[model samples]
Target: MEHKALWTLKFFNFDPSKTQNKRRRQMLELEEMWLHAYDSSRSYKEQLKSKWSGPFIVKSVRPHGAIELVDPAANDQQSSWVVNGQRLKHYLGGEVERLSTVMKLVDP
Candidate 1:
């Protein structure tokens, strides 16, 4: 059987008025969720290791407020994020890992 590579993207939007402390906590939790998702997906892990050279990266696209993730092998696979035309974040692969919905937490 041949294994085909797949990509994912996830989006999460937060209220602009949330407190900084609340936002910080939310981001930390979101990172955990992202890690869980990454670990559960075998293809994602292998691709990240086989393709990326350094640690995984996340880039923020402002205004629209989107974050792009890069692992390794980004350049080879065109996996990094671009703003206007400039490439942002470290190269993880020629192709980027599929993104997923951003995890949001309600203020507590």
Candidate 2:
């Protein structure tokens, strides 16, 4: 029991004050866009998967730099999930441009 306690103490010896601040200053902005990291384990074929998914909108910012995402299609809270800032990447319309090009090819 003493060994276990000492191990636990050593494992949690991190200083809360020394934790690095979030590099993302835009997280606090309302309706900011983000791409959520995808769970690649769910894919049956390893090569047919993307690293991140969705251009989800930021619904709200939590106290510790966590963010609540908004469902763009549904516009409801039912399908939303909270994720840490590090797990997200800014969605800069590259996907949208690709989608538009695909749509043009199909329609034309």
Best by lDDT: 2
Give the TM-score comparing model 1 with the true structure, all chains together: 0.24
What lDDT does the true structure give each of the candidates?
0.59, 0.62
| Cα misplacement distance, residue 43 of candidate 2 (Å) | 6.6
lDDT of 2 by residue, 35-97 (tens): 222344445445433323457778789989899887676655567678787878777766553
Candidate 2 has which clashing residue pairs, if any?
none
Worst 10 residues of 1 by lDDT: 1-10
What global local distance difference test value does model 1 have? 0.59
TM-score per candidate, in order?
A: 0.24, 0.36
Error of 2 at 32 (Å): 45
Q: Per-residue lDDT for 1-108 in model 1, tens only?
A: 122222222113444556687989999999999998878897777875664456555554555545555545455544665333243345555776677899889999
Give the count of colliding residue pairs in each prediction.
30, 0
Model 1, position 107, has a per-residue lDDT of 100
